[model samples]
Target: MKQKRRVRVMVAKPGLDGHDRGARIIARAYRDAGFEVVYTGLHQTPEEIVEAAIQEDVDMIGLSSLAGAHKYLFLAVVELLREKAADDIVVCGGGIIPDDDIKRLKESGVKEVFTPGTPLDDIVKWVKHNITPRQD
Candidate 1:
């Protein structure tokens, strides 16, 4: 029997967000939950994040933004993925985002948004239910 490919997720910190404690924790949670995880350290541009996601052939991108640039930075990643025709890679975000912006983010192509205090297990379960590893 052929084994299933593990979900591959890229957790990224976009823009000038200097905070990464949450990103680190979630990366660990995904790893512990049996997903293949790649974490891009702090101070990453949306372009850098998108490029890394594509190169890594990730099934999804979990962008973390603590610095108030989620409106711009997060959308940029989604847009870049579309431009690159890699929109098949699911994009989601979390961290310090205002509830008001969450609606906009979702409408703009982000699959989901997780605010503060969201349980790690919930996030993992969402990934398991929503994402499938690339066959290639």
Candidate 2:
């Protein structure tokens, strides 16, 4: 118990990624960890993700894409975050992304990316480490 703040999270599945078993599990893990999680259902676009994040003022955005469109979808999401001036929100993703794409995703402003087999504890740890109380 590190005296956590209210961590709001939005778990989304973008593109044509029809595989959401992992996403659902992650959302449940976050909820069990005492986070306020807003789960965006399948096939969400970048605009929708950003809109939800801003409207909800979430601390983190989690994307689960397995449709091999992660590269395009992720870039769009990052660009939208910048466009809406929501770059302060922490972003991470999990799915069937390749090793090379992970580096590129990080370069494109995604703070972190988790592939299949990543433990829920690792995801929770990343959020806890990255999100902080607003000092402003």
Candidate 3:
């Protein structure tokens, strides 16, 4: 079997949400799973998050939001990445979003959405399997 490159993932909290327990947990899990991980501190704007991802050259971005603004904030990050020609970076979200919103979020460019109770192993496995290796 071919060996996949180690994935680099950025865990970010967009918008005014100050809660970060989940994001931290995910970041640590990614690290333990042998993926490089970056965690952007809380209250980051979409632009800031995208900038960090580009600077760090991450393979994927995972957003966690509970401020009831996941739709706008998550989509904004995806749009910024698209505008920067960095759409190759896989984007995913996790939080208290409703099932109805998850569909729209995916349509807006989020590759997947994880609800509050999703297992970290599932998230790690999904990312490892789904991320497209960066060529540059």
Candidate 4:
């Protein structure tokens, strides 16, 4: 029997965002793609997201933030990831993000940011294609 490759991911809903249908969809997609995913329900703080990632030892952190607070949430998460020295985890997701904001977020340690309407296969491919072991 072939051994299954393990790829743990944390799908989190950060900040004051309450809507979660999208986050749930992405979680199911990742699971169907054979990844072990940890879903952090709505209202997660940046600290909670990072702590969950570290504790769960996830390979990626997928956030669904449509509350227009991605700037604050993403920046805090990035800073905490750096503080915890777990910046290797690939962070990616989609939402109602503006085009220019997407570029800014990438500079702050987000590996990839998907815009609305991105195919599920594309997300799975992105994780499989870019997720790598931590350099530490």
Candidate 5:
């Protein structure tokens, strides 16, 4: 039997948002689910997060924002990825996001926005179903 290649995911905190307990928890969940997780620590700019995503060569970029700047911050990262010709990278996010904004977020390129209380297993399953890992 062939072993499946592991998926690589980058969990990032963008903008001035300093509350990272949720980010940390999700990162751990992803790690525990057998993904190769790269976490960009707190207080990262959109540039920093995208740059790290490229450098890390991640399959997906997961943004965590709780400071009410999800619109700007999430879109910024998505835009940068497009600008850099890295649009193939999947992007997802989680935090205190409003239900009303979820549609706009998906339309703008975020594949998923997992709000607080979302099951960790659901996220794991989503990634497994959605992304086809890049071959090195």
Candidate 6:
């Protein structure tokens, strides 16, 4: 029997957000949940995040931003992925984002958004239910 490929995900801190505790936690949670995780450290640009995601061949990207630039930064990553024909990679975000902005982010192509205090297990379950490893 052929074994299933593990889902590979990149956890990124986009923009000038210096806060990374949450990102780190999520990365560890993902790793512990049996997903291959690549973490891009703080102060990453959208371009850099997308580049690393593609290079690492991640099936999903989990972006964290506490700097209030989610509107611009998150959308930029989605757009770049489309421009590069890599939109198959799922994109999601979490941070101090407002509920209003969450609606916008979802409408703009982000698959999901997790706010503060969200359970780590819930996040893990969401990934397991929503994302599959890329076949290629």
- The C-alpha TM-scores of every prediction are 0.96, 0.92, 0.94, 0.92, 0.94, 0.97
Write candidate 5's Cα lDDT for 36-134 as tens digits.
Answer: 999889999999999999998899999999999999999999999999999999999898999878889999999999998888899889998998789
Q: Clashes in model 2: which pairs? A: none
- Candidate 4 yields a Cα-based lDDT of 0.86
- What order do you get sorting by lDDT, best first? 6, 1, 3, 5, 2, 4
In model 1, how large is the Cα lDDT of residue 31?
Answer: 96
Candidate 6 ranges beyond 4 A from true positions: none
Error of 3 at 108 (Å): 1.4
**Candidate 2 residue lDDT tens string, 8-110:** 8899998887888999999999999888899999989889999999999987789999889998998898899999888888788888999999999999998
lDDT of every model, 2 decimals: 0.94, 0.87, 0.92, 0.86, 0.92, 0.96
The local lDDT score (0 to 100) that residue 42 gets in candidate 3 is 96
> Candidate 4, which segments miss by more than 4 Å at Cα?
1-4, 133-136
Clashing pairs in model 4, backbone N/Cα/C closer than 3 A? none
lDDT of 4 by residue, 54-135 (tens): 9998888998889899988987888899899988777775788998889999987887898789999998898888875443
Among these predictions, the greatest lDDT belongs to 6
Worst ten-residue run, lDDT, model 1?
127-136
> Residue 98 of candidate 3: its Cα lDDT?
95
Q: Give lDDT tens digits, candidate 1, residues 16-56.
A: 87999999999999999999999999999989999999999
Q: How close is candidate 5 to the true structure, as a TM-score?
A: 0.94
Off by over 4 Å in 2: 1-4
Q: What is the model-wide C-alpha lDDT for candidate 1?
A: 0.94
State how far residue 53 of model 4 sits from its true place (Å): 0.7
